[model samples]
Target: MTRKPALAVVGATGAVGAVMLQILSQHADVWGDIRLVASRRSAGRKLAVRGEETEVVALSEDALTGVDVALFLVPDEVSARWAPIAAAKGAVVVDNSAAFRMDPEVPLVVPEVNPHAVRVRPRGIVASPHCTTLAMLPAVGALHAEFGLRELVVSSYQAVSGAGRDAVALLRAQLSVVAGTELGAGPGDVRRAVGDDLGPFAAPLALNVVPWSGTLEEGGWSSEELGLRAETRKILGLPGLRVAATFVRVPVITTHSLAVHARFENEVTVERAHEILATSPGVVLYDDPEAGDFPTPADVVGTDPTWVGRVRRAPDDECALDLFVCGDNLRKGAALNSAQIAEAVALEIGPGAGDRRGLGSGQGPGSA
Candidate 1:
């Protein structure tokens, strides 16, 4: 009988972590024994896995021992600290945070775009791209193959869930306040209107749009915007690519959508762009504008694949193509993508890939 590799999931109690568990359960026939790990506060909590209830354990160095692969869906700081420890213990770590994405040694991967990069990871750590970038990678990669991409101008309509669980709660509470006020009460009578301010976000997200996601960096761009620029260049193998982004958080529950305007090195007609996207792996083109067929957040909330629609050519620039794409930020954007990276590493190291090593030894391709 063939032995399935043992796997561990860090942050196994949070939003993306829960989705990771669900995806793993759905694919149980392929996975081995699964272990759940989280912060100390969430330890000893029971979570369902493959029809059995499992306890979530606190993440520690000892928990990583004997594990074949560790999937991290925790905060950046937690990942920055624990990922190295997990890698040192001989487990391939597929991190779903921004901790090491742009590191020279670490590879920021979207499997459909750059699977080969996963193989050369010397750090034994593979980083998943930002949720926003993952939503658009397959589409951009397809276009790049057909007509070399030169520049990209993207505007992301991100969901509140991207900010974490607290942000989701804030949105819900704010909505309640707004609803109460609309029912014959004055604006100041609502909890939110009278400064029951829980600042999980900069502004009220219940019925409003905030033009920022991450905090602003040196260049006046939010960290979320910078992530798009960096991750896109890394995945597309265009280190010097010209890319600009504007990321905004919307009130939607899940899924992220992008409005991408791309200019190619050579001329790319709208017809040809649509044809390439139609056959692209992990992409569904729905470009019948006249028929009101287009991708929307509602249509993609729980979907794994990125949906593409509204394909058109820029009126002034024939070489530029504009498209709208959407995908579930929690699934493909985080959990599923991290799991796919782990699977790719397992394939590279053979079925029995449970060899453990000390911290200072057993270095791989992108090791520190």
Candidate 2:
């Protein structure tokens, strides 16, 4: 008989947390005895799991007891506070926040890109790459392996869900107002709109794009852009890798798309790049320009794989390639990536083994 691993999901009431539950439910054979944990305000709320309702428990020291793995989907503050305690208590933590992604000790992971990094977790926490970074990893790693990546330039068309649940609500409300206006509605209907309040965004997100995401950090880059730059370098094991990112908040509900141009150390052709991408794990090559085939957020939303298309060789082939990628920001970008890390950890630690001392045990306090 196989013993199922006990699991805890921090921030179980949040958007990514909810998707984490769904992904786990879909992969029940790999996990068992799941615990949904949230903040005090969300405690006691019931969430549906496999057609059954599970009560959410408050995230406390006691909640980590006996769990084999804990997946954190909470904000940076909450993750910073509780992840260490959870690790110390024996649960291996797979964190899906920016809090630990850049920490040298934490294995910033994308399973297809750096599964080996899982074995070097001096810090108990393993971090999922930022959504943008995660979306780009499969394809980039493939190219890197074949041609050696030297520099990367990326611009992201990010979805509102990347902002949070409130952003989704705000987008929906704004769309409703826009619909009313398009149908020839009055000023009262326009100005006193349902989504006039941009709680999750800095400006109106209904029909406009917001260049900023998270707070502005040093060098005019928003936290979101910096996360992409930093997490990409860490996961690819290229500390000095040259990367620049522009993260923009689009009106879409899910999936983030990236336009990337990368220069490689060795010469690479578009056809060769396509071949590598086709065989790479977690990447689906969709480059059929004749059929107008290219990845878009609308096509990738709710999907697990990173969809790739529009492959081209840069005019000045200083060994550079250009590509377009789209992926579900909530899935492979966040929730599924965390779950995959936990699965990898489980495989590394061996089936039914709950020891927390090993790198694969999914147990360790924060190294950050």
Candidate 3:
């Protein structure tokens, strides 16, 4: 641990991976060496990282050699296959996939929330929560800490990009097809226009808000809805927390937005919730509807922090409060969280954190 940590960015050429490289450049000087890794087809390609053009290497044991922290920003299948390889090669793998998130041995970490969980990494690997969950977790976590959260109800307005590049292209194509159309172009019109360009989503995402996001699960709930319920409970240390979620895909490009109604053990007030979110580490408070100030995806697309607004106490339930939150799905929801985990890991391995060899039991801001 004497030397600076050597970082490896898995899936270095993908959408979230590119954002990871950009974040590394902006947050440079934390790690010593940076390695760009991608698929075999993209292995020989070059990518600029921290102003230097670095060659992309295929995921392999040799490529993972000497890597202190490996960020996997690939598909869940890829992570299921390659993350163990990276970890086996002495790298602390911070995975941004759904593959290992629910695994009891792998901790699903949000730096602003349960960072202390980073310690006891049973598999030497950590899982980053899905992007949609991150859209409001930081804000909710802060409020929960102060109010003793007991239940949650979240409605998500997710962007098309959350599905990936193909989904983005599908939305753009559909938008172009209806650019000059009239106002009331019904659901049938959108479905006919989008045709076969649905890509990953089950329905057309342009000019429409699909009530479903992620694959349909048992009991009529989507995977995204289930993920939000599970992840929030894990991060907040509330295994039996009652959570009701509805995930919808909106015709947007970047950020994910959520309307959260969180019920706490004690009564909550609009003023108190605002104060907690304002000073929260990863949350930005922007509530002032009179002055026309609220967090929107378009306004916060490229930002780092989770933007929170529309703070109010639920009229019917004194113990519940409402909030609207938005954040860049690709950055804070994916790449930034992975980088923060790596930074947290590095801190434990670095000088002032005390004996660097005890990373498994390391304790700090982002441990678990």
Candidate 4:
């Protein structure tokens, strides 16, 4: 309680990890000793934090000792393996991967929506929702609080940077190759014209939109679509909520936007929804189609708040409304969310943190 707690950032060399470092720098000083941690390949590399070049350490039992909080920004598989290890070493882990988002014990948290959930980490771990699920929380969550959301039809326009750093490179090269020729006129245009380096995406991403994001799952829906549905239901505490999503990858480099049609249990109008959103935290209302005042990835990239606009009532459904939302995928969608959760943990349990429960004293993940 008397001292700032030590913090560790796992996956310090990755995309989200880099953003996590930037966010921590921008936030109020809430940590004691900040350590940069990554895989063996990244270990020993230096990254500046608060004007100091911190050496990166490999993820291991020794690297995580005495950490009050371990903010994970690694891949799902890496987080699945190392997050528990970090927690066991006495750090309250706030994971930014999908590995534990749906876990019964791991709290899926977005501080603006459900901050109290951060205090009860049954596994000594808190999970951040997928980037797509998180992108809509502030705006949609504020509306749900007012109108009692019951159904959602969401379509996401995601950016390529969400895939990783290499995908960003591929997109830039493909754009140059297809500058004027109908821009991805046909399939394999990226591969035939540019090199065959589309990264993990299912289709070419030059000027074309890929209707798929994650792998295909049951009922012919892609896993990303299912992720949006499941994470929304979990975060909003509406287990039986009717939610369907279609995720499409766009050529943008950062920020993900969504077109949301939400039906509520009570009557709603665009005017009332705009009033609620304008006064809410972490939401920026920019709807004014007449003046062309709306938000795009260009408008919200590198920002933390969820930028919402185009508020209107559905023509046929009086109980329904429509809106557009945008958020920086790497910031609020991943790194910033975890950082906020960590700050909540610090405030709740103090510098001593969960030591009373065998966490703050550098104990292993108990029954984790």
| Clash count of each predicted structure | 8, 3, 7, 2
Error of 4 at 107 (Å): 0.5
- Candidate 3's C-alpha lDDT? 0.85
Q: For model 1, how does the per-residue alpha-carbon lDDT over 258-322 read when each residue is reduced to its tens digit? A: 99999998988888888889898788888898999999999888888889998988999978999
Quick one: ranking by TM-score, best first? Answer: 4, 3, 1, 2
Of the candidates numbered 2 and 4, which has the greater lDDT value? 4
Q: Candidate 4, residues 221-340: lDDT per residue as tens digits?
A: 998899888888888899999998989999899999999999999999889998999998889999999999999999799999999999999999999999999999999988988899
Clashing pairs for model 2 are 92-362, 92-363, 124-364
Q: What's every prediction's RMSD, in angstroms?
A: 3.1, 3.6, 3.5, 2.4
The regions of model 4 sitting more than 4 angstroms off are 180-191, 352-368
Q: TM-score of predicted model 3?
A: 0.94
Off by over 4 Å in 1: 180-198, 355-368
Can you write out model 3's per-residue Cα lDDT over 1-368, one digit (the tens) per residue? 45577788999999998898889999846787789999998999999999999999988889876677789999999999988877776678899999999999999999999999887687889999999888888998888889899998889999988788888888898888878876335648778865775787777776778888788799999888999999988888899999999988899999999999889999888988887888999899999999999999999999999999999999999999988999999999999998998888877666323223235433322233
On lDDT, the stronger of 3 and 4 is 4
lDDT of 2 by residue, 265-368 (tens): 99989889888999999999999999999989887899899999999999978599999999999999999999999998877655555433333644333332
Which of the numbered candidates is closest to the native, going by highest lDDT? 4
- TM-score quality measure for candidate 4: 0.94
Error of 3 at 225 (Å): 0.7
TM for candidate 2 is 0.91
Worst 10 residues of 1 by lDDT: 352-361
Q: lDDT for model 4, on a 0 to 1 scale? A: 0.86
